[model samples]
Target: MGPSLAAPIEFSATDVNGKVHQLSEERGKWVFINIWATWCPPCRKELPELAAFARAHRNDPIRIWGLSVDTEQSPDEIALFAQSFDLSYPIFKVDPTSLRIFGNIPGIPTTFLINPSGEIVARHVGGVTGADLMRMIQRNQSNK
Candidate 1:
């Protein structure tokens, strides 16, 4: 967990389907923005966990989005990768070296947990399980 951000982070990226998704638009729900890459083993491993977590919270006030830093792969290839993992959450393609909104990535598989108000409350720097995510959400909720 990290200190609450002073201001809500804002950015928008187009998904594989070409639909633009803005972080600010998800203000009323908890949002998990996962930065990953197709070549990263840990990133590939966490997809199923994230997918399950998304499904489990489908009706809840939570949203999970994946950002793939694979510059070499085409949108169709990326979409296929998501399909291979059964990842139904929105996944976008981004430049790995330039993620200004979330600051320095430091590593792949980094995940940012944004509160309902859009403030970034937690950041995980490695692969995370669905249980780990749920625990973080519960812990943050209890803190409030």
Candidate 2:
């Protein structure tokens, strides 16, 4: 097998509610670290779908995190966006440096699927739906 890429699986970011979310604390569960922005249309379109995914998988060993990478937007604006949608998951406002773990973020709507062991299993660089999220979960759990 080819040498594996070690994505930085540890980082901390606060949610809109002022709760600090650390990837390490979510051990023994699946984690979805989604990097998105307020101005990205695709990202906007996928928010609710992702919220559905979060609710659907709330009881499962998985988590869906929506991190806003909008460097130009205010937290209040992002919070307004969250309120408008009544998002199911916490929306984290991260600085550009905090997202360095993902490496060379070219655009919005990037998602990383992490397994229970804290290993990144999938990295999607665009929008995703509830169906897409479930399939990835099932596929990865089956492998485990």
Candidate 3:
């Protein structure tokens, strides 16, 4: 199942670099908001693929943001984790318990795909590959 669209979800969060990123600000592009954790095995495995996907689409109208739901870790710790993976995309530390904007995050490694219009078009509960993401975008684009 996918997100229940109840008017485009909006949120503002500060990334590890102290940069404020808002979902509304990315309205004109495809946005991937991935909720992950530092200790999750699948999250660790998918970081590189998400990073590569972000790099490959750097010039495109696509954006990927990683939200680390590691309540036990500090910002510096999360930053270090991202750095170790060579992840260049924006990473934010968020408390999963307080993240009501996206509804219940049943598990880690959950990814939400938001369309250019700001509506969530898809949601995946496990690790995903770059190819899988691209295919999703392509399919959505074709449907439009």
Candidate 4:
């Protein structure tokens, strides 16, 4: 995972709490955009680590955003999933078509690391660990 990635297409969606969250607001911080679905096993496996990453880097200027791609799942379902992992960050129902904005996401648990300037820096298309995540953040911070 390195630099020279494309800029993410700007988008926003309602968080689990029914509040509108915008991608543009994530500027000036290291943002982790995780594209996932409830039915994906790998996605489920990665949630806890994502949550841990959120907590571990709380003081840092970093944000982890989960984009659930479930077509028919309600906010309650998403809430339950987030609760199961005891997620400290927010989850949003991003439109399936929105994945096109980042290029074709061929798998679940896809993750994109967007720098403070809103440019994507790296991507992981499978399970990831909290340690690995921490390393990515550190790398970004060092680059900045």
Candidate 5:
């Protein structure tokens, strides 16, 4: 789903490691933002692929962020979960209200693919494959 954001979605959240990351600071890179939760099955299944997507495209200007929307879990717990899966992307336990920056996220496992220009070009409301991500990012680049 493609919806031109009324304005470039901007957010700043602390990563599990305690480093603050901001969307606006990530200029010139394709920001892959995934809103997930520890208890979400789809999110669990998609984590590895998102990590792989980030690894496979390491040479590209892609920055994948795994934002955990698990209100019940502490950052330490979420970080432990990510560590168990060996997820390589930056992981953060974020507030559910952070979803409003993009739009009304119907549920967990919502992901937004923002292009280098800071425009959200694609979104997936469920589990997504690495191939799907590759194609979409490639197609987005080709269009420009």
Candidate 6:
């Protein structure tokens, strides 16, 4: 709920393809790093909208990534889940130790909005509506 616009955090995680993707490479774009688990209700509910947003703004400099924190799910299962949602953006299988470095994730469906300069702009810890996401993008544009 606090304003974390100036706080900086570098996210280091690999994509589904197993290639390492660093936040340093995602500069000059507003990256929506959505943290979710397979079993969370709100995570499941809002994921489709997230996918649609990514697809709709394919040409935009915005990148949405779904980071699954589930330790029990395999890569194939995660791929199937991504396919089921028709997800357009990248979905990464994150290590629990990696996640723990970010924060104590006691809940599911947490989101972090990173600006073009790789700074954490905002943090949403629950279900986010499509309108809410749209407004975030609009705000990011306005800042530019």
Top of the candidates by lDDT: 3
TM-score of each: 0.92, 0.87, 0.92, 0.87, 0.90, 0.85
Cα lDDT tens digits, model 1, 86-122, are: 8989999987655766775779899988888787788
- Which consecutive 10 residues in model 2 have the weakest lDDT in total? 1-10
* Model 3 CA RMSD to the hidden true structure, in angstroms: 1.9
Quote model 5's TM-score.
0.90
Model 4 scores a TM of 0.87
Q: How well does model 5 score by local distance difference test?
A: 0.82
lDDT of 1: 0.86
Q: Assess the local accuracy of residue 128 in candidate 5 as a C-alpha lDDT between 0 and 100.
A: 86
Residues 25-113, model 6: lDDT tens digits: 88898888888988889999998889888888799888888899888998779878988999988889888667653554557798777
RMSD of each: 2.3, 2.7, 1.9, 2.9, 2.2, 2.7
Residue-by-residue lDDT tens digits, candidate 5, 109-128: 98888877777777778888
lDDT (Cα, 0-100) at 20 in candidate 3:
96
Cα error, residue 86 of model 1, in Å, equals 1.0
Residue 6's lDDT in candidate 5: 36
Model 1: residue 49 alpha-carbon error in angstroms: 0.5
In terms of lDDT, the poorest run of 10 residues in model 4 is: 1-10
The per-model lDDT (C-alpha) reads 0.86, 0.79, 0.87, 0.82, 0.82, 0.79
In Å, residue 17's CA in model 5 sits off its true spot by 0.7
Output the better candidate (2/5) by TM-score: 5
Pairs of residues at least 3 apart in sequence or in different chains that clash in candidate 6: none
| RMSD of model 5 against the true structure | 2.2
